[model samples]
Target: MPGKKRILVLGSGMVAPPCIEYLTRNPQNEVTVDVASAADLDTHVAAHDLVISLVPYTHHVAVIKKPDGMRWLGLFSTEPASIKNGNIFDTLCHQLAKLLSFKPGERDLVMLQHKFIVEWRDGKKDTITSTLESLGDPEKYSAMALSVGVTCGVATQLLLDGHPALRTPGILAPYKKEICDPIREAVACEGVKLVEKVMK
Candidate 1:
């Protein structure tokens, strides 16, 4: 909410080229890209309202694990992997929790907000907003992993499908619906899922 929007961009892959270029051109937004290891993902993701992921589809569900604040996302691909299969990072967390006596339940609690401002023909203005209060179960999904990986998967898929949106070669931002719409549909077919809600 500062004068500039702070966005966390994850990964350094093919799509990172155009996407990062597009975001940096805008002076009002502060964008930082991180090739963070499993150890640092939580710190970076917590600090930004927006995150751009560019990893493989194999990593999304973990990032989406219920954290209180849900982020608006642009994803690239989806590959199915089991949540029960704990990786090295998981074991590390387990060791830390054991040493510190931190109950796993203490980790749940994510909060996210999205706001839309609308203007009418009469010049009246109103704001529409949505909030997500999430309870994270890292076992269900790794919020850190999904937060940084899902968008990359979606972006990756768009690149592969040659979604009608990438009609140009020179540096271009892929946010247009002509591009986003197809990417969403394509990701759905690939067994990827996304959910959004409006609060009362």
Candidate 2:
């Protein structure tokens, strides 16, 4: 298709399907999933317009640093190994998932909170806290999967749409309100809840 946007997605764990589904909803998007590794990283990275790194956080720095001369937007999510072999990381993840698996009709909850402190020269300090809490439908998606996957999808779409803050050259983290608000709003539209408070 003409004017299609190609997206390369790294990792294929639980969260991946939702993210991939969300992106492909747009007819112009062509998303390809890959198990990110040293051998195939460059070739895949160079081929796609954007790369979503859903691989484990420990591997992020290495993945980001590997494509030296390549330019592509990236959205990072935390998870485990990308390799398909029966390694320790893969085994541990499998055992952990089995142990934590939710029973039928049971919903999973996910909560994320961030606190920031600001102080004036006069000595007064104020604390700001932001929280996101999402509950997943037992018949549909897990809270962890929905929260991470939808947020990743939202960020990826924002980047593709050329959101001002996200278009910057190097690595981008959604720490700022400009970048985060849109994601938060989009995630909420997908049924995730968000709250913010300030305390002096």
Best by lDDT: 2
Worst 10 residues of 1 by lDDT: 68-77
Q: What is the lDDT of residue 91 in candidate 2?
A: 51
lDDT of 1 by residue, 1-200 (tens): 34656778787643364455545655766778899687999999999766776753333234444444222221222534233336745443333333333256544344567787778899977777755454444454334333324444455435434556765666566577787776666544433444454333
Best candidate, TM-score-wise? 2
Clashes of each: 23, 0
lDDT of each: 0.53, 0.76
For model 2, the stretches where C-alpha displacement exceeds 4 angstroms are: 36-38, 56-86, 112-131, 196-200
Please give the RMSD to the true structure for each candidate, in Å. Answer: 16.8, 10.9
> Candidate 2 local accuracy as lDDT?
0.76
The Cα RMSD in angstroms, rounded to one decimal, for candidate 2 relative to the true structure is 10.9
C-alpha TM-scores of all predictions: 0.37, 0.67
